[model samples]
Target chain A: AQSVTQLDSQVPVFEEAPVELRCNYSSSVSVYLFWYVQYPNQGLQLLLKYLSGSTLVKGINGFEAEFNKSQTSFHLRKPSVHISDTAEYFCAVSKGNTGFQKLVFGTGTRLLVSP
Target chain B: DAGITQSPRHKVTETGTPVTLRCHQTENHRYMYWYRQDPGHGLRLIHYSYGVKDTDKGEVSDGYSVSRSKTEDFLLTLESATSSQTSVYFCAINTAQGREETQYFGPGTRLLVL
Candidate 1:
């Protein structure tokens, strides 16, 4: 069984400021991690994913996340944010080895970028 | 961009009514999923289909049923609508290319149960 925890329900940051959204997961086996973003009144869009190899992965809209195995965390970050970047971010995990792709998602973190 | 579209983008109904949401895809992907999004709870899978006529329940499948008679179409039906079931329903398709697997979502259907 795998579960995801996103502690921050809402994060507020000024424009051009750096922001980080924390995500932690618990799993008995290796898993695949993913970050998705959803704008108002829209479905989720894939931001990035960590399957293997590099711990640091870059995604669209100048977003990146680091997969820290030791801490069981996959935190998303952006050096600078824009007002347009305000959206809801979700962290998900699925069993790596299992053929089935069932995603367990976190509650989500709402990012508010104000100028 | 996965050529997925959901029918009746928004709907409203009263309790005890039967509602069915349709998901149509042109990608011909083998896997399709139904998920509901609500305030604070994120998205919860209602059901999924690996292929035509092959469907399985997900974490929150108690009040919903799904059907897939053709590769391009997947339908999710609510037997009896309730206020608790009103939510934003999304349809997604899973595509696996070599070692890469991704799920593309549709615009979503907003259902308001009165």
Candidate 2:
């Protein structure tokens, strides 16, 4: 079985400051990782994904994450944040090399970028 | 944004009533999924369909029943609405030809069971 854990339930950051949302997963087999963002009243949008090569994956709105296999982690980062970036960010994983379509999601980290 | 539309964007239904939520896609994608979002729980998968008439249950499929009669349509029916079923329902599609494509989500349907 595959599972994901996002330690931070809520993160408060001032505008223009960098922030990181921590995520870790546990799986016995090869996996796929993903980040999704949900704005107020909107459905989730794919931020980025890690399928194979390149430990570092870049996503929309200047967001990026690194895949650390040894650590079993995929942490999302943004050098500078904007108030518009305030949203709930979710980290997820799928088992094996398929679409990882049947995803197991984390509890989520609400990034509150204050102006 | 992948030509996905979730009907009855908002609804208030009573207990014991049957409700069906419709998901229509214009992109002709082969996969469709239904998920419900609740406070602090993130999105829980209710059901998924890889093709017409081919459906599978997900982690939270106990109260949900789904059907896909055509390539462009997938429906989720709540046999009996309950307060616990009140949630924001989303429909997503996987369009990537090879891998599980990044899911493109519909606007979402807000159902309030009172």
Candidate 3:
């Protein structure tokens, strides 16, 4: 079984400021980690994913995340944010094997970017 | 959403009514999934289909049923709508590509159960 936990429920940051959204997971088997973003009244869009080999992965919109296996964490970060960056972010996990592609997601963190 | 379309983008219904939401995909992916999103709960899988006529339950499948008679269409049915079932419904598709189990989602259906 796999589960994801996003530490923050909401994060408010000024424009051009750096921000980080923390995520942690628990799984008995090797898993694939992903980050998705959802704008108001829309479905989730894949921001990035970590399958193997790379601990630091860069994603769209100048965002990036580091997969720390020792800490069981995959924290999303952006050096600078814009007002348009305000959205709900979700962290998800799935088994690394060839099993069913069932993704377990976190509760989500709402990012608020103000000018 | 990548070629995925969920019908009746928004719906309002009363209790005891039967509602079915349709999801269509032109990508011809082999896997389709139904998930409901709510505040503080993220997305919970309702049901999923691997192929036509092959459906299985998910974590939150008690009040939902799913059917897939054709490769391009997957339907999620609520036998009896309830206030507790009011949430944003999203449909997703997964291809058999590589070891990466990436899923593309639809625009979503906002279902308000009164």
**Candidate 2 structure quality by residue, lDDT tens digits, A1-115:** 8889999999999999999999999999988899999999888899999988999999999999999999999999999999999999999888644443887889899999998
User: What clash pairs does model 2 have?
Assistant: A99-B100
Q: Give the runs in model 3 whose Cα sits over 4 Å from its true position.
A: A97-99, B96-99
**Is 2 or 3 the stronger prediction by DockQ?**
3
Compute DockQ for each candidate against the true complex: 0.62, 0.59, 0.67
Q: lDDT value for candidate 1?
A: 0.94
Where does candidate 2 stray beyond 4 Å? A96-100, B97-100
Task: Rank the candidate models, highest lDDT first.
Answer: 1, 3, 2
TM-score of chain B of 1: 0.97
Tell how far residue A24 is off in model 3, in angstroms: 0.5
> What is the DockQ (computed on Cα atoms) for candidate 3?
0.67
- Can you rank all candidates by DockQ, best first? 3, 1, 2
- Regions more than 4 Å wrong, model 1: A97-99
Q: What is the TM-score of chain A alone in each candidate?
A: 0.97, 0.96, 0.96
For candidate 2, the per-residue lDDT at A22 reads 100
Clashing pairs for model 3 are none
